[model samples]
Target: MTTMTTRTVEYPADGLTMVGHLAIPAGVGRRPAVLLGPEGPGLNDVQRRRADALAELGYVALAFDINGGRWFSDPEEMMAYIMPLLDDTERMRGIGYAALDVLRAEPRTDPDRIAAIGYGTGGAIALELGRDGVDLRAIGTINAVTTGRPGEAANIRCPVWAGVGSEDPIMPPAQREAFAAEMQAAGVDWRLVVYGGAEHAFHHPNVDHAVRPGVSHHPLHAERAWRDVVGLLAECLPVTE
Candidate 1:
């Protein structure tokens, strides 16, 4: 295993002080980096571990936060906060950009060779960054099948790969179709993977808090989705040893 370094980073975004986790691989020179986004509930050990795993794979990884440093355990509270932000495209873009800037500022990150992979709300932000015309190597989202403003997807400069649960009510087939249509209309390279027998946020493990209906974890699909994202990164942003 590669020796990895980890730390907490704070930055301003969306009128809140966002606290994020940063992980760097052991190597000396700059390396390809990844911007990781967590689920709507907020950043936790799950995402931090993911950053470490990415670092172990030879990439500088930043697990950015969404709700500042607060992690909402109540489903109602999580929705109350996220619903409004979801409607505000600029706000979402700002959050994503702020995290991206922090990641790029890291001495170990190769600014030109970075990718964004987010789950749920974080996934939406990644798409927003792509829509905002950021030059990303690849975009990967889990359970975030969101569409941007009219004609905005044309700004995406890299391949996009999204994974969603087949039974997810929040991102039903229609929403997925619409997202795909938007990507197609913009002529962007994109693909969607539907994990059968899974529910919303299936990539996430069962939490200690109360979750809304239609959300459950499937260990098998979660691992499969992880592999898919890793493959996407390998294809678009290879990490050299």
Candidate 2:
């Protein structure tokens, strides 16, 4: 079984007390660390499971909360709570940096081998961190809507992998194409994977209530996306055997 720990940490941007679930492999000595950012507000069991899975892969993973200890079953309510926070890019960067600090401070975590993975709004934050030159080894995103500000891609120094569903209305084909163009123009080592027949929030298995006509989860695509994420991380930030 993987060793796991939970703690509450204060988000510096809003001074909100947020819960963090940390999982680490047993008998570890400075293992690679990953900051797993949640989809909305704070983390839930799904995010914890992702961290646990990372631990099983021999990496120390921490899923930090952007929202306090609250979650919403209603999609509108969740969007209302999360959307206002996204307007403040500086605050988002602070949250990401604070989470990175928490992960680096862990005994079993290797600060130098750190990377980040985010979902939905969190994915934008992950990209923001990379754009701000956070010195990460790699960054990965799942169904990110925001392609970021102008000239932002040029600032990213690490390898980035972004996965999106072709059917995702939130991130349409034009947006993905533009994002790809920006990454290519910036000369950043980036890869974009458009999964066919998948939609937004595809990795979120519990998000059935928010299923729109063009937005819902597919188990097969989600599995493939998860595997691809793991493979990308392994390639960029492999754990020391």
Candidate 3:
């Protein structure tokens, strides 16, 4: 096993101070990197741990912030902030790009080989980055099957993978189909995995904050989704040991 180094980084985005967690592998030389986005609540310990895990796998990882280091414990408060941001495509893209720039600035990262993975609101940002035509090796989202403006998906130059829960009211069947349609229409390589009997935010365990009604954790499916995302990364951005 390789030792990993972690640190707190601060950057400006969306008119707020963004605090991100960066994890780097111990070995020398540039390595493929990943930009990690957290759920709507904000960047939490769970996401920081995920970044560390990615570093353990020999990839530089950065878990970017959404609320300037603040975590929203109230559902209504979270939505109050997230809903408007979601509606603003350019704002979301700005946040994602800011985080991407931070990751690329790390000396250990191979900027040319990078990927973006996010959950929920974070996932939407990741997709927006793809739609913005950022050069990414792969894009993976869990419980954030969203559609972008007409004809924008054509900008996505890499494969996209999305995971959703069958019982997720927030992202019901219709929404999934629409997302698939957009990807197909754009001729982009994309795939969607529906976790049977799961609900919104299925990959996230019970959080200290109050989540929406349909949001619940499915440990089994969560692990499976993690594996799927890892597989996507390994296939698209393999680490050269």
Candidate 4:
């Protein structure tokens, strides 16, 4: 069985208590930790499952919430709540940094070996954190919408691995290419993997809506992206033997 603890941490800015699941490997001492930023709206069971899986792999994982404790069963409602937060770039960056700090404060987590993994809106936040020079060991994103302002990629210091669906209309091929170019120009170590025929929100099997035109999930691609993320984490922030 995985050794994990669930708790709520208060974020003073919004006066909202964020739910988090901290999973630590059994018998491991001061292991590396991952601050997992959830998809745009909030922390869901999917993110929690990922955190649990990460903990089973011998790392302390903290899956945090940003959406003020509201779970939108309707896609429209989820977008309504998420869009506003995405528009506030500074707040998004703060959210990522705050979560990172929380993970670092944990006694079982190795502060120096900390990293981040974000999905969807959380992915953009992860990129923002890297751009702000967050001293992260590495960063990974899954189906992130790179809607932030131009030249923002120049701020990233840590290596980034971004996974996207080839058929994701929200982040089309042209946009992905431009984003990759910007990262290259910034001299940031980055890799972009496009899974053919997949769509946005591929990581979340529970997401049933087609937010983008002609886009849907691909289980095989999603699984591959998950493995790619795990491999990137291992390569960039290997656990000490």
- The alpha-carbon deviation from the true structure for residue 82 of candidate 2, after best TM-score superposition, in angstroms, is 1.9
The per-residue C-alpha lDDT of model 4 at residue 16 equals 62
The residue-level lDDT of candidate 2 at 151 comes to: 88
Off by over 4 Å in 1: 207-210
In the range 32-99, model 1's lDDT, one tens digit per residue, is 99999998889999999999999998899999999989999889899999999999999999999999
lDDT of each: 0.94, 0.83, 0.94, 0.79
lDDT of 4: 0.79
Worst 10 residues of 2 by lDDT: 4-13
- Give the alpha carbon lDDT tens digit for every residue of 133-189 in model 3: 899999999989999999999999999999999999999999999999999999999
* Per-candidate alpha-carbon RMSD to the true structure: 1.4, 2.0, 1.4, 2.2
Clashes of 1: 0
How much does candidate 4 score in TM-score?
0.91
Which segments of candidate 2 are over 4 A away from where they belong?
A: 1-13, 209-213
Stronger candidate by lDDT (2 vs 4)? 2
Give me the overall lDDT of model 3.
Answer: 0.94
Q: List the residue pairs that clash in candidate 2.
A: 41-67
